[model samples]
Target: MQGKAGNAYLINELVRLVYLTYHVQDAGYGDTDVVVYARAEAALERCLQRAEREQVWRLEPDDAPMFEAILRQAGRQPA
Candidate 1:
């Protein structure tokens, strides 16, 4: 079994992960970025998966960064 977080908690974490990934990308930590971003994406996916499994809620655009915002935050470069 996996640990679970409330919807509010998940959103907060999602925001953090989004920023953390951008930070890591800019830092150019090589395989370290892979390790971290994989975990971050997995966390996002797992949150949605759990929500679906429990029939509680689904992923909402309101919870995601806008494309412009993501670009701004992540910078205009590949990871």
Candidate 2:
């Protein structure tokens, strides 16, 4: 969450759901930490605005575990 840029988006579901992704500079000095937020890209703009007002903007709680699991399987993790 430090020295990073955060991003968010929505997925067209039964009801639109917002999600967030972030990336921070790699502590060990890589090309820069990068978070590829494919699932949430479509809703990014709105999600960011909401996060600014609410102080929290992340995938809905019920959806998070599954999202993270997918990321892990893909060899990625939230930054």
Candidate 3:
């Protein structure tokens, strides 16, 4: 995992999980399944943290906006 392919894979994984979280909330399961929602949120947080720690955005300027958008969705300030 180095270079554009790695960046793309990480971004895709983040996007997939974010959409899954959104789907859970949109389906009203977030209210009924606290544990599930919490787990999803936790996973997203961990992914976001990893992206930030790796400086993924900075590594690939072309992918920066996408990473920033994901960060914002996770209520994190993009670095």
Across 26-60, the per-residue lDDT of candidate 2 in tens digits comes to 32322312433344343344445657887555444
Q: By TM-score, how accurate is candidate 2?
A: 0.29
Give the better candidate number (1 or 2) by lDDT.
1
Can you tell me which runs of candidate 1 are displaced by over 4 Å? 1-5, 12-16, 27-32, 56-79
Ranking by lDDT: 1, 3, 2
Assess candidate 3 and give its lDDT: 0.49
Clashes of each: 0, 4, 0
Q: On TM-score, who's better, 2 or 3?
A: 3
Q: Which candidate has the highest TM-score of all? A: 1
Q: Which portions of model 2 miss their true places by more than 4 Å?
A: 1-38, 42-47, 76-79
Tell me the tens digit of each residue's lDDT in model 3 across 1-78.
234345656646765755655565566543333444455446445545667787552133444444444435445222
For residues 1-79, write the lDDT of model 1, one tens digit per residue: 1233257565556657466656766677323334445555555675677676884433444433342344354554454
Clashes of 1: 0
Task: After superposing candidate 3 on the true structure, give the runs of residues whose Cα lies further than 4 Å from its correct spot.
Answer: 1-32, 55-79
Clashing pairs in 3: none
Candidate 2 Cα deviation (angstroms), residue 52: 2.3
Q: What does candidate 1 score on TM?
A: 0.39
